[model samples]
Target: MLKFENVSKVYEDGFKAVDSVDFEILEGELLVLIGPSGSGKSTTMKMINRMIPHTDGKILIDGEDITKLNAAELRRNIGYVIQQIGLFPHYTIEKNIAIVPELKGWDKKKIKARVSELMEMVGLDPKTYAHRFPKELSGGQQQRVGVARALASNPRVILMDEPFSALDPITKEQLQGELISLHQKLNKTIVFVTHDMDEALKLGDRIAIMKDGSLLQLDTPEKLLHEPAHGFVEDFIGKHRIMQNPDLMPVTDVMNDKPLTSLPKRSPERALSIMRKRQVNTLVIVDENDVLLGIMPAYDLIAKMKEITKIEEIMYPPEPFLSASATAKDAILVMDDAPHGIIPIVDENKKVIGVVTRGSLLSALSTLWIETEESE
Candidate 1:
């Protein structure tokens, strides 16, 4: 656990960048620090590893004071990624990832294995890119290398300072999805700094809102959206932002109850006909009780209609689905990882309650925009 007890940073010229900030981040939590420029979010995050020493109060990690620890040793164990990526221009990808392990005197074989594992973890093929210099890769790939390098030493905590702000929208979105997947798999303690509230809501386990160097509010995304404590908090987050983002609402609100479905016994030809009539690319295959069996794609059914006997034969397992009680935010986060474009919202008995599609979710989320446009 990490805690800030009355933490404040007063510059030499007597400017207070942080004022009596107090919050604790639980282990394995991803906490986001966000505010306008000069709000001191960056300074607060940097103080975690003593990159910026606090002028007043204490910062503790696992109940030990960070100020008491050696700054070099403290930073070595805590991974940090920045907007610029900060890869050494001349260093190869393998060498870059191996830096921390080498500093601790790991043998070449161990470092090599660790580097290879991290490379694959970040979705880079080690054999293809290990020897390439930082300049050889695109902005996104270099950022991936930076992430791998940060994780090379197996740090329990990571600090990301606007890590994806430099990438193109497509790459940024893709990386955001990948980061969510990585967080779930690794469960690392992460402190991310970003000015984007939407990014904060999507990534943060909890968000810390700051203004004028003072911590205004710290709460979960749902709580922050629904219960903005201070007037500044509400204004900074935008009062109407919640209405614009339906992912903060219940999954049922964003899902369609009447999704196209097919029985496992239904012939592929019959399923294809239904797909054509409905103008959908996929169908949920259900049993006699309306319980989810699997999903059938139009392309698969079309390819196997003559070769397959039943829709079930061409259906893929619905491993990634949501319970009816799940929040829309849960569906949004996992949507990118779902193999099928559609996610079945199921009841406790495994009966399909509704389905959340890309279209359904987008339409529900964009309702405010559509209304605004119509009003204009």
Candidate 2:
């Protein structure tokens, strides 16, 4: 747990990067700090690990004032990752990841084991990537090494400043997925800084939107989207709130209308063909009436090749179907647990109307933001 009390920061040049921001982060919660550049989001994060000292007020970690702790020791207990990744160019990925543990005076065997464990934890195969240098790895791969290094010492808290910003959108999403999965397992208290509203909404347990070096609002993504504190907050969120909320809108209203490739009865070969062709992970399962049946995920199909021969064999019931009349928020929740990135939308008659994929929702959100910005 972490707490900031009346925290503020003013550079010697007299620019305030943060202003009396106060908040508490619970254990295992992910708190997102989001705002435009120079909004003090980064300054706020730095104070947690004492990377930047607070100009005023006090910061406490687990009830102890962080200012009282030695900076090096305090930071050792906190994991930090940044957009630049900051891995040593000359060091192999394993060596880079082992830096923290080594600094902590861990023995060679223990440090190596931890490095291997962390590499795997972040989805990088230790056997393949451990000995590779930073320059040899892709941006996303380097970022994973950064993450692995941060956790090398088993820190209870993690600080991330736009950790995914340097990568392509596809890679960024992949890392975000990995981060979410890692959080669910590790449950470390996380403070993340970003300018991306969508990322904040997806990963944050609560979001702190800042402006002019001051805290604007701190609340759940739903609350922040549904009830912005002021015009600035509204403008910041743009008009994407509607698409982010799936409960009020139906899938038909936002679902992709293009004819989708479907598999008659799920077969590993058929599912693989469709997925490979569409570059998708999901296949809609329907009966003669094109009625909603279930969904077969590409991963599941591949993992259970023999069973996939029968649509019913590989088909797992959808999390729960949403009606066309349902809100977009409902759709979001439905898709949250969907592995295939698809959610089924049904008619009142319980017949399948269509499906909403992640791409559709994101596109709708972008358009909504542009439309709202233009209106302004």
The candidate that achieves the highest lDDT relative to the unseen native structure = 1
- Measure candidate 2: CA RMSD: 12.1
- Local distance difference test, candidate 1: 0.90
Cα displacement (Å) at residue 296, model 1: 29
Looking at model 2, residue 240 earns an lDDT score of 49
List residue ranges in candidate 1 displaced over 4 A.
251-325, 328-376
The RMSD of every model to the true structure, in order and in angstroms, is 9.1, 12.1
81 Cα displacement, candidate 1 (Å):
0.2
TM-score for predicted model 2 compared with the true structure: 0.69
In model 1, what lDDT does residue 352 have?
92
Per-residue alpha-carbon lDDT of candidate 1 for residues 194-311, written as tens digits (9 for 90 to 100)? 9998889889999999999999999988788768899988878874556556567678878999988878998877788888998999899899899999988887777777888987
lDDT per residue for candidate 2 within 98-201, as digits (tens), equals: 88888899999999888888888888898999898999998988998998988889999999999998799999999999999999999999999999888898
The stretch of ten residues in a row with the least summed lDDT in candidate 1 is: 238-247
